[model samples]
Target chain A: MKNINLLAMLSLLAILWSCGDDDDAKPAEFGTFQVYFDNKVGADDITRRDNGSTEYDFETSTGEKFNLSLLGYYVSKITLEGPNGEYFQDEMKASASEAKGYYHVLEGESASQNIKLEQVPAGTYNKITFAIGVEEDGVLEGAAGGVLDPADGAWFWNWNAGYIGFALEGTAENSGQEYVDWGGGRETLENTFAIHIGGWKDVADNENFINNIKTITLDFGTTVKVGPDLSPLAHLVTDAMKVLDGAAIDFSNTFSVHAPKAGKPFAEQLPQVFSVHHVHQSTSGHD
Target chain B: MISKTKKYLVYGWVLFLFWSCSDDDAASPKDIYAFEKPAHFPDATYTFENNPITKEGFELGKKLFFDPILSRDKSVSCNNCHQQSRAFADSPLHPTSIGVDNRVGIRNAPPLANLAFMQEFFWDGGVTHLDFVPINAIESDVEMDETLVNVVKKLNEHDEYPLLFEKAFGVKEITSPFMLHAISQFTAMMVSAGSRYDKYVLEGTALSNEEMAGMKLFEKKCATCHSGELFSDFSYRNNGLNDSFGDLGRGRITEDEADHGKFRVPSLRNAELTAPYMHNARFLTLEEVLDHYDGGMVDSPTLDPLFKDGDQVVGISLTTEEKTSIIAFIKTLTDRDFIAEPKFRNND
Candidate 1:
């Protein structure tokens, strides 16, 4: 009777150990989500022109003819939300060598437009939110690397000591920019316009200080599942016309906008500029 | 349970003995290269965790500081404007900074010392971070006239710099942040806390009778703006510099009409060596600066209220004797040890 009881006890212990092993076999599910920024001027696709290009490819709401030579904006602090309280916040870190969350989506850079976020918990996310510009937190990190490195084509304003949030450089037909010799092989051509929007400092006591960093949120219009087997890509459209029209920019008068107060209107229009064009749940590979 | 409690007490006692031994080792002294805060001074404002100071990094920064390679034409460097002999301030000959191609800067290059404590940089307080400060000088048309992209490229192409950078930051390729970090490591180590006033505060060293009297008067009158151990409240004030604004000064940065002609209250440390004072290098001597305070001030809309007594703009009521005493006191702030420190010298 004693021998039979010992055998039964040993069998029960083995069964429990196997059950624990079975639970450990399956890990928590995580996946990747791709955010594709499709930049456009109204309904037409954007084709970047040279700095001195006279051929105006786009027209504003006010019927002002212009062509983009350079255009870009920084995006950071991305978050995805679901209807059933599922939330995923992208990690933010600014070290000497890396600025993790900040993304400089520039025109003509095809690889820079596609932002791939990895290690996202498997869930059905319906809404996406992100800041249009590098905010106070990004600036206060002192020195940063990757896209935030000013040495490597980062649009940084030296005197003001902040990154240019959004930049639109082009030649407008009605631009009043006079030709000037900057010396040392640098020149500002006639009819050329450059609008650089920056300044994150917003002191509480100082009312005049402008914080032009803007946040934008867009609904997917349809829920997309994210898992190891399925990866969702959100296609967002950025319309430059919305900013030019919404701000009611007169190309002649409002040509050079490099300051924070001057860029307030342009930054304010950032929310309406970005929209969810479409989303795709691809089984494999990044587009 | 009683035996377990007794065992924990015995373990704690042994650990305490080891901790005490380690504490004694730490108390003996720190390395000369290591950044140590003077007990009298406030905590450093620099973010050390991001770029911790190493011997190699500090040396690289020092090399960069004195190198003319940062300039567009390789004709100017930080040392060209900020010399060590003048306490890292520009020479009195150059009222404002004389940059590359003999191009003159508008504002005076203020002395560089105890920068780790400063919250802002430049006369207008435009730059909030010390790392960002060099970029202004490098990119300024009147100064270096070199773009940061070009500077990084130049450094990368150099034979020794790439390897030096690797040793300093442990990176295979050179980047701007690492370069900036290396510079910060050197500048942050420039802690000028060995002045006579500091010694008097920390070690109870005696000051001359005149200096003591000046100290008392300064505490009574000037301490409102230039307060604390580091000196200067770091507030922006017009100080009745001018009636009209040529350079908007602080207003240019803030875009506020009220901030016109307001510049940061500069620290008085090494004030004796740093001649041609104020934002525009208006005052030639310490006596002239005191004279400006004693009725030579030009009134402005944004003039500091401290200088104003109702409708009458009364600058500080300082007699000639009082001025002499204040100058004597201010001279005590000159740190000979800091200027003569051989480690800061450019060996190459």
Candidate 2:
């Protein structure tokens, strides 16, 4: 009887050990999502010609005039908010590089690039949060390493020690009937030509944070998928530009222009700019 | 039952120990020192963002400084011109620095100590920051004669360099920023405030009679321009080296005729040790430098009015004894502790 009892105990211990190993095992799952920025018809699309000529093409709501040439700015800090408020953030920051992040959208061309976010935790997300340009506070704090490395020329001011957030380079038609090429550093303290739209203290008053707090609802049901409509974000950016120009507002100092302890003008303008694009979802989700 | 409970407790403790050890191993390396500023000096113009100072980064920089691989033919290192004993400046014998392939440079290689405090670099002040200074030395036709891309590639290819990069930055791949940062870590560490002159100012130490006399003379003449603790106002002035080297120093950068003969005033901290004076390396000894200061001022359109009379003729009149005393006073500026410090030496 004693021998039988000892055998039963040993067998039960072995079974429990196997069960513990099985409980630790987990399956890997990943989901796909896209974020967009529309920059079509919100502000004046100023172009500078090769012969120092400047021209301004204003955007009209009725007819969609494609102004794809004026579509180059850095977007970073991409995060996705799920249905349950669970967040999935990307570790990789995007910037212009010789091998990557170089986008030049010509006139009448589709000005959009698709970025793949691999190894994202499988979940349903609602709102997509990201900064329009590199964060102003990040630059001021002297944060090193990432897409904003000064050596990469993404954050270069020639001699000054700061980065340009939104570099809009092209020809603009000046009062002299000549095309004046305007390129400004993101920080516009000294030189007047460039609309440097970044400063930590009064960035909102100084910068046009006209396109912050964008939302997109996404649902993934266990499948490897490529969703269309990622290109709509580019349209939103253009529309926001039109709204910005209609207001006759200076994006550079929209938040705070002179002082550090000032409030951003984003509260007054974000509603008008983002209202142009209503939330659109795809029925055939898997592509 | 007690035996069974003890066994479970031991297993739990063993698991906890393993995890705790792993967590400790995963923690990142801490920075050894915070950025320190001298009380006597103003706020530094160049902060360490491009090249953060870490122990490993600083050590790597010291290695690169001594390594001759920076040159095209592996003939001359930065140390060949910048010797520590002579306060990191060229010797009096060689007026112009001889580079790879026996190529002689136009200007004298200045001392590489106390550069963290400097605003502009080189006599011309063409280069702005310490991070960019190595590029001037590496790319110049007469200096290293190696491109930055090639230098970066060479360092990346080295067997030991990948590990060094991993230690400094958490990445194995060698980058231009990492390389520059490492070099800067070493360069920024070159502080020289332990000189007898510093002791006299800080510790109330007494100076020799000749040094005292020279100090008085320096106060009257030199202090107007070469002012403050670092011994330079960090401004470009035409000290009348020559009316023409065909090399319009600071004017090349600004494109202004007023800055034609102007060069950044060099710090006199290690002036006694770094001989062969002037921007073009024209003077051989301190005596020659004193003679030039005494009577060698050249009259030009943009010459500094400090030495200018009603007619603006070149020269400051100093007696021979006064010049000797000035040289004596300059010798007290040498910081022996700085030259002999093993931390600045090449680890490799």
Candidate 3:
């Protein structure tokens, strides 16, 4: 009778062990999402001219007509906040070989126009936060490879070392006819104005100053659901003229900014520039 | 119940996991004498706690320092300009150190010693951290002429470097950060605190009569700038070497007209061995440098006030006899033992 009892107990234990011991312990499900940045000056689409000469035709909020030849900046360290305290943090990785997190937003470049994120926790996300440029940690790292490499020439300042956050190179008819050679000699552009917005901040009691703002957040206008059957898209637009808004200083007086004193006023307006235009979601549920 | 063998195995595995986790502890010292600092000297400026030095890490760093693989043409190593025998200063004949493809650098190569206490790197102090110093040399068109990205590729492709990198930093793939940290490990090890002057000051060792006189003169005449046991106040100032700026020095780095012609006050450690002095290597000998300081100073807008009296540049008030005695004192700072430390040599 005791042997039979022991056999019955062993069978009971076996059955309990077979009840999804590990697999059922909170399985993780992920889905895909896209963050698209629409670049513009005011009402017109922005385009970048790499060589020779190219023109960007756009109007300001005050209906002031201007043309741009170059417009580029870095969009890095993105964070997607989901409902229920679930969040997807980008790896924030870049090397000489490839980039995992950083995106270079150019006027006409499609490679960086849409930032694709995968393995985002399947949920309804309401907020997206990102950095407009490389952080101090990234800048002082020294000898970066890949997207962060200083040799890219388009991004970093070589001698007085730092990265240019918002670089706009072009000629404006309202530039007071100040024709000068840009950057020692890129070309003798006429009636041109260049705004290379880059600056660094110093911490209290610290002697060193670092240039890169870490936090720029945007609400997705509406909720974005990402699931097995639901893939959402968030469209955010970058307006260049906003850097000049409420700056108190007129553009005709000073247009070039290479350091903090001239650039801080503009950097203060950068966080205000990122706003979600629209979000798209399908009606299908998780399949 | 589990078998005794299985129970023992489980216990062993847990112990192993705990032991491996100890590596992540930040407070624990990696080595008893990793960064040997003198008691008389000020605290090291480097954040040593973040990237603690180990025996394996230092060894790997020494190898990279001696290797020419970082150069674009594979013909120039850091040791080419910074040789151990010359106290890691550029060779006296080469005012500007020769780089890959026989290119010439604009400024003289500065000595690499007691750098942990320095506030900045280069004549202009363009680089703030010790980790960032090597990058400038590596990317200079007239220096290594190599991009750091290419260096990573070369290191990853090499058979032994990847393994060495793994041993230093537990990553299977070699990275730029780990490589830079390992290099700093080697550089920070170059502590020249055991010099005769340090021995006399901190250890109460005896000094010669001439050496003692030189010490007094150095204290009174030059100590305001070249102060402390590390022999530098870490300030950037113009010494009135030129009436106008050519290289712009600190001004070029700061982009301020007031800072123009100003250069970092270099440490006087191993001054005897690092001759062909000044940023341009214009002064060949200790005597010539003293002569320039004693008189021959040009007036500049950014000249340090210490070297000037009203409109005229007073320079240092020193007799010929005092200059000779000061040279005797500066020679005492050459730490032979520190330069010849076997651990810093290329063993690989």
Best by TM-score: 1
lDDT of candidate 3 over B1-348, digit per residue (tens): 445555555555545544644555444564533686778878888757556788778888888899999888789888999977778998898988899878888788999998887767889887766776777888887899888778978999998999898888776877666777788888988887778988898879999999999999999998999998878887888887888878899776666677889888889999899878898887999999989898978887888999988988899978999999999999999999867877767775
Measured with C-alpha atoms, the lDDT of residue A152 in candidate 3 is 47
Question: Tens digit of lDDT per residue, candidate 1, span B22-126?
Answer: 533332365777789999888898888788788899999999999999989999989998888888999999999888889999998999999999888998899
lDDT of 1 by residue, A2-76 (tens): 544454455545445544445553338988899998888999888888876899999998899999988899989
Going through the candidates in order, the fraction of native interface contacts each one reproduces equals 0.66, 0.01, 0.11
Query: Model 3, stretches more than 4 Å misplaced?
Result: A1-36, A53-71, A75-131, A137-158, A168-196, A201-234, A241-273, A278-287, B1-33, B47-56, B156-175
The DockQ score of candidate 1 comes to 0.36
Collision pairs in model 1: none
For each candidate, the DockQ is 0.36, 0.04, 0.15
User: Docking category for candidate 2?
Assistant: incorrect
Arranged by lDDT with the best first, the candidates are 1, 3, 2
User: lDDT by residue for model 3 over A70-188, one digit each (tens)?
Assistant: 77788878889966776888886543244567777876766667777887878889999988877666665444555665544437654555567877666654554455554324455
The order by descending DockQ is 1, 3, 2
lDDT by residue (tens digit), candidate 2, A1-287: 45444545655565455445454423255545543444444444334333222233543344322222333445556566556645667664221112122222222323333344444555555455544444433433332444454433343332222334343322222211222343222232211222233222222332321222222222332222223322112113334353335434443333122211121232223334432233334322211
What TM value does chain A in model 2 reach? Answer: 0.49
